[model samples]
Target chain A: MSKKPVKGEYIETDTGNKVSRRSQIIGTTNIILGGKTVIQAEVIIRGDLLRTYTSSNPGEKQGNPVAVAIGRYCFFSRGCELRPPGKLYKGQFSHYPLKIADHVFIGPGSIIEAALIGSHVNIGANCVVGKFAIIKDYVRILDGTVVPPNMVIPSFSIVAGRPGRVVGEIAEGEVDGMDLREVYREVRN
Target chain B: MSNKRQSMMPPAPKPPTSLSSSIVIAEHASLTGTKLIMIGSNTVIHPRAKLNSAYAPITIGSTCIISERSQIGILKEPEDEEEAEPVVIENGVVVEVGAIVEARRVGEGSVIEVNARIGKGAVLGKHCKIGPLCEVAEGEVLPDFTVIFGNGMRRIDNSGVEDLKMKMVARQVEVLRKLIPSNIAKFQ
Candidate 1:
């Protein structure tokens, strides 16, 4: 078993703003925070760890922000991580931002970096949305479920698991879909 | 001759883990000597945090964020099973809101998502992501920068990404920090 890393010890690149131990901020990988977005601590922007997208919007930031575009009246709980779109690369490191549509609810400890999330999405607590995964509007990701990279979740669906399979389609304003264990298979190589 | 004996005294009992000012315990939490907590500078423990370790202590690195409503505890040994070891979360790691990590070691810069449960002696690599509400079984090792979200699961060891009985979610581009789990097996 390996140990966890220290927070203050690492250094960030010259580009983005500093991420304090526990604070909220907006950054590229494509972040569009709604005018009234209220985010709490343990929140993170999943910028391109690989620098995959082109962030050359000439200050406008063409690449994805960690959050693409948050709508008004959005509340992000603690421990949320957002991944934006960036330049895609075969191997070379590029950068992109996350694209979040309007009116999304990101629960605590949720990770949505480098993905395309549509409007009115309610991501449950501790749900992990992979890079480049497209989630349409009204999608509810259950707690502790995993969304694979580059996968597309049709709108109004509920997903849960190690590799989260779509348990069922969520009705309008509906929560609670399928059993996490039944939908997702245990992660095996 | 009896007066000289006054100089001899037994060592003091350790302060309860919650009382150690060296470590920051969040509000609405209780800690005791049964738990050991080692945290780096500027690490914040949110309200309603609870760490109970009869088997081992909870260690966190500097500038890390342990979110609210989180329960970090040691797992009891199963019937006929030897006592398990302590849970160690290294520097720069983020234990997201409502996440539960009960393991030997979680690597630096790794993110354990909300409501995630890590089993005994599981080692996660640096910059890795253990997605929300996921459960990683014991004796699993994750390499650096690997993303374990969305059913992406793999195991690690001395040799690189060889296929195991376990399924790997995905290994990212970055390298995780190299660290060995602190040996707490003898404490029991």
Candidate 2:
């Protein structure tokens, strides 16, 4: 079951994105990983679930088909899954793109199906951010939290529980700790 | 240590019978064990999705989406039973990421959400939705349109939207067929 290790554990991209060799990332053409992102081992990013429904607006320029878009300095821990959420819209079943901004730290074993995750967010281990959920900037989702589908979590909030509820707010002093630059640097082969 | 771990692992998966020509089974998907496994057309089996039929056979119908890390089939035979029951996943079922399904039968259009566990011998009816991280006890039977959510809360969804949901599953499968590169030949 074991293959010979040809090189280092991670393949660092030209843009400085460090992707683990053991990561199961499908449909690489449809995934956009901004520079300085670290994808740990056993992570499954489903970039194959691209949007199929075409927009009716003729004048609007067609954007590149992307299933998942991640910004810089993001850390996706081991065993986490990033899936684009799908639903029936106007009689067409289509998957929407999942977007994540910079400095986002997603803990291990979390399954994220959220539509948008803003900057400086920290999601704890075993959390499930449901489909179409919008998480704004500076949010901290506690461990084992199950954020329900379509739930919107505003900025500076701490969310927890099964059907995750906003339990508290993050203070201004605590927000600085959410930066993932240090975390990214420490993840060595 | 690595050699010892590899020795403990199960034998290489035997190829399943009756895999349709149009099914999209990824090259990395693990089809394991030593029993008959049948998959219908347009079903998308993502990478790392496991179909373990060592204890019993597994039958998956058309347009089903078995996501990554999800395990289908029973882990072991029951102590009291002489033979293990086969797992039957009906048409249009979506077993999401990391879910472990050991169900006796999962009816059509059911959605087993991420990390959900359907215990051994559980029977899920048509259009049933098991929420993320939820657990269905072994041998439990759920009725049609049952929505099992937060902390084991139960509700019947007679919302008249079952047709739309099924259509969505079909469309998702259609899109997946074009996106996921299938290695059906390897599995066959």
Candidate 3:
């Protein structure tokens, strides 16, 4: 058996991101990542599941081919998956792009198919953020909670339970703990 | 992606799987143990599936189907005090896509659905059905024919569909065994 890769093991990019070699990222041309993102081992990003349709509006992002777009300082833990949500829109089945904003941390073994995840969100381990779900800024999703598809989560709220219900709000002081710079500094072999 | 027959680390020199002659592991499936991971006859492991036995040995029985991206034999947490034992999966088990299993024992004909997690040291009894996205807590003991679903609701199952499913899985194994080359020579 292979020994566990150490906590300090990672590949440092020119843009300051830390990515593990053991991560399974398919079709890199279709995935966009902002600087300083941390992608841990065993994380699966399905960038190949792109939109099959050509949009009429040139200004719409649906015309572009990006499947998973992540912002700065985001952290994805081991065994998590990022797959674009698909649906039949305007009589055509297409997989939409997954857009995640800054300072978001997704925990281990979570499967994310959300349409939008706003800034400073913290999702705990083993949670399932369903397809087309909209999670607003500063939201915290508890472990093992399954957020149903297309649920619009309000900002700064803590969500738990199956098909997720808002339980509490995050205090203003707690947002500072979402910074990933300290973790970025230590994630090097 | 599957690792090459030669491992990168010097501490683990042997090829990482012990497959029976009829077993079919896809080219992209990854096994991370030489002496600790064993597969029985007529088992089918799909692409992108991972089996890691670093902290413990793993024994998978005959006629098992481990679907794509499903994980087996995850290590126990650091805070866990008990010594890790082998993860044992009995005959005719089906672990569907993307599920993570680190259980101590998975009994015969159990069906673990998509994205479900079986935590460390948990024991699943015969013919149990763990529904999609369900979470079985660490060290929990589930009885035979138990069905877990719908926001953690559970009950003893009396459904008699396992025999038909077993025959179907056997047919699948027969087909896959012919398609995927028996790569046991390189591993053993």
Candidate 4:
């Protein structure tokens, strides 16, 4: 008889992050997960691609060493991937950190290589948010949308299509539904 | 091409019927119901690729590459059908990273790219290219040399340039064989 993988299989971190053992997370040391986040099975967070370039800004060291910084109450569904964006700057290859703000929900099979994703963003299934794209607060990306590289998405907007465009606006009252507390509670075995 | 004939060496070698001894399956791969799966010689299944043949038998031909997070025969066969036929993938196919192929037939030298989905009962012909992030709808039939690309666009690519692609895939398979540890006995 084949044994079924047990449901509600999650490890509760000291910071309240519920991570699945089946998730393939490389370079865990380079990832910073805030409290109450959920990383589901088959989710890959690639932290091995670290920044090789020194800080070009004033008063900074060569290697600060952070690849992925995810905020509170974020839910990464099964088969999704979070990859840090990399580029050649000054003829040197380097990867930048993927910064995700609070209350974000990424659906299954989606690939995120965005530089910045603001709070309360809900990206639907199989969407691909491209490299260095900046997304502001309260954004909802419809299922199967592909957000092109370096694109900017404004707040309170709903985006869809291939190379995603603004399709609609989110009502002010709908903001509360974006809270991930209920979703977090339901994920428990 | 020599590997193709060797894989067809008759059903007499039938004691260990399903899983082939010549295939390289990663130790971490989840192979549920191995009795329902048949992998030809020189196939390299990357670590973490899920091949669940519990519902339907899956037959993958020689020198195929199943990449990480890619799956074959994993999804439950569509419920409405009275009986779902087994999936058949012919020789020299490359199923790339994160692809989900539940097709009825994947022909020779086909390349299923990253994050692509081949829906249930789809038939992809010889040297077909299913581009990254694309989706072939369920039961769709694609002829040989068909190239499906960005945003559901498709066209026939009959330039006959599979030699370079096969060489690159072979090199990738060589690297993967060294990178991922194999445990063929675990499923056998």
Candidate 5:
């Protein structure tokens, strides 16, 4: 059966973000947190925390350090795995990095691979953000996703999946706030 | 030098006729650019869209709607194996605008929504809603009423689908096995 998250419970984003389906925020689990350190979600200061040790190799990168610039009033679902930003590789090989800005709403089962993600971005469920991908601000991605490596996603765009094609640009002045409580309510009913 | 009257007047352009849905095709749509093969009557197809059957055949039942601005790429295997047949889209399926279906069969009452993509050799069972922008990967089979709307790795990482996709090259090896007609006759 497909694993879906229950309502009002907080799942920690240790080593990775919560990547489950339809988790709730009303229960004892308050913060969807990451890491063994004391830095808790919804309490950490909203800014770039340069805590990740950049390494080009996955073998060299130990203990999965993820850097988060989480903003106020944002909703994150379960099973979202946010690995550390930027893989700094030396020598004559291709290198990749992931940069997530503030107020980014990531859905369940989404994989962000060394991507440049801007603020106010809403990523749909089960999407794969490939290496070196650039996603601009105010972007909404639909479900069942695959973004190829080295591709650029402009601002205010809505992308649906299937070999990942860009259908149309979202019009300006359409600011939709993605509240976790609202999404949780919708999923429960 | 024969002073033949050169036909200076361009031949009168034929008037555009309102295409009826009931026109009988002398050749199948496979010969033309249409990938969808309609079994029943009263199916409508837009003029602007490109329906290609180079890879597979899309079979559609009667009373289907192939909307405008939809590009159907009924694709076969990327590297052709001699044995693989065309893809099929069964009858009574509605493919919306901007939806692309590359599969062999989309069963009856299945709706491939706008901007949705059904991958090569994928099967959509009856009454399924392939939600907008969803990507159903190659050879992935969905049972009836299986509403999948998001992207995912076809199987759990390197073990399941990675092995299956790699073995896809041998799918055409069955054609060579069928070529020995004399051996079959001896068995009979």
Candidate 6:
């Protein structure tokens, strides 16, 4: 029997990130991906919506100008989008950075416009995380959930519904399953 | 030699659509169909937004923000006997991510939230708000200040804060103009 060599589907970067060739990542200069991350095909990461407002403190360091920052062992599934949240503040409109911590997994076709997502978070398919929504650590957002704008989700919560609300809690033992380290390894390409 | 030189210079191609100089259209935004698409000044069209004018023309007013994956245009042509009306979006309208707008007229300062669908020929009055994932049936007419929200609930917003909201939309357009680099020449 002849063995066929399967072609890899992802482009592995030097920093141990596996990014698909078909991903539509805009404004690449403003995006920071930590090592061991996997970005699947057709995923759109909008890093162009950077903060336009400047602080008054001239002496303070400008620091990093990143618009979308994702930490280690994260996974973005096919057709998902990551967009920084923007709002009108004090009569000025500015986009805030989307910060995602380690071991996060976002499912297919989900549109995330959250300001912050903590570690070990798993967002299911076709979900919409609204503007400035803060999802804390070890949370599971079920499929098709539409989290309202400015919602703050606590840790270890299971959120579901149109205007998403915490329907249940994630047990301590189940928290281990939320980690995306194993899922990252499984995407060999 | 003079004839050869004249032959080498190709004629300039005519632009298919009309766009104001101050509008910001991203490089990846799709503008399809044979009919004319007229976009006014200070409008920001995000990447991957689809504007199809195959069945009828589309007129988008000033200071509008059309977000990513949102589709604008009529779903189909009108019946053989009737004429297809153009899709009209007035000033300060906001169509959020992944929304489908096939409205005959989306009134001034209206907002269509993410993933919502405004069906064919719907006439929305000024300052209407359609919430996320909501569906407005085809040819439906919504009054001014109508807010369609959770579980298809309807309400009228009489807070008299429309001026403030319109100001916010204008500010958002200003910020987006700087953030989204426009390649209007490519579309032309």
DockQ values, each candidate: 0.11, 0.75, 0.07, 0.09, 0.03, 0.65
Score residue A51 of candidate 4 by CA lDDT: 67
Winning model by DockQ:
2
Residue A136 displacement (Å), model 1: 1.5
Candidate 3 CAPRI level:
incorrect
Full-model lDDT for every candidate: 0.56, 0.91, 0.83, 0.83, 0.49, 0.92
Candidate 5's DockQ: 0.03
lDDT of 5 by residue, B1-188 (tens): 14534688984332222223442221112223333332345444532234565454545455555643356655444575553345555545666545677776787666675457887778777666675456788887888666655453222122223223212212211211121111111111
Give the docking tier of candidate 2: medium
lDDT tens string, model 6, B38-99?
99999999999999888888999999999999999986777787767789999999999899
Instruction: Please give the ranking of all candidate structures by lDDT, highest first, separated by commas.
Output: 6, 2, 4, 3, 1, 5
- Which CAPRI tier for candidate 4? incorrect
Where does model 5 sit among the CAPRI classes?
incorrect
Task: State the weakest 10-residue window (summed lDDT) of model 5 chain B.
Answer: B179-188
Which sections of candidate 2 miss by over 4 Å?
A1-6, B1-13
lDDT by residue (B23-87, candidate 4, tens digit) is 77877677764346788988998667878676678899988988778888738745775767678
DockQ of candidate 1 relative to the true structure: 0.11
The structural similarity of chain B in model 2 to the true chain B, as TM-score, is 0.92
Winner of 3 and 6 under lDDT: 6
True contacts kept of each: 0.23, 0.95, 0.05, 0.05, 0.05, 0.77
lDDT of 4: 0.83
Please report the TM-score between candidate 2 and the true structure: 0.92
Candidate 6 docking quality: incorrect, acceptable, medium or high: medium
lDDT of 5: 0.49
For each candidate in turn, the TM-score is: 0.46, 0.92, 0.59, 0.61, 0.34, 0.92
Error (Å) of candidate 5 at residue A98 is 40
Off by over 4 Å in 3: A1-8, A56-64, B1-5, B8-47, B50-67, B71-97, B100-113, B117-131, B135-149, B154-188
Tell me the spans in candidate 6 whose CA falls farther than 4 Å from its real position. Answer: A1-8, B1-15, B77-83
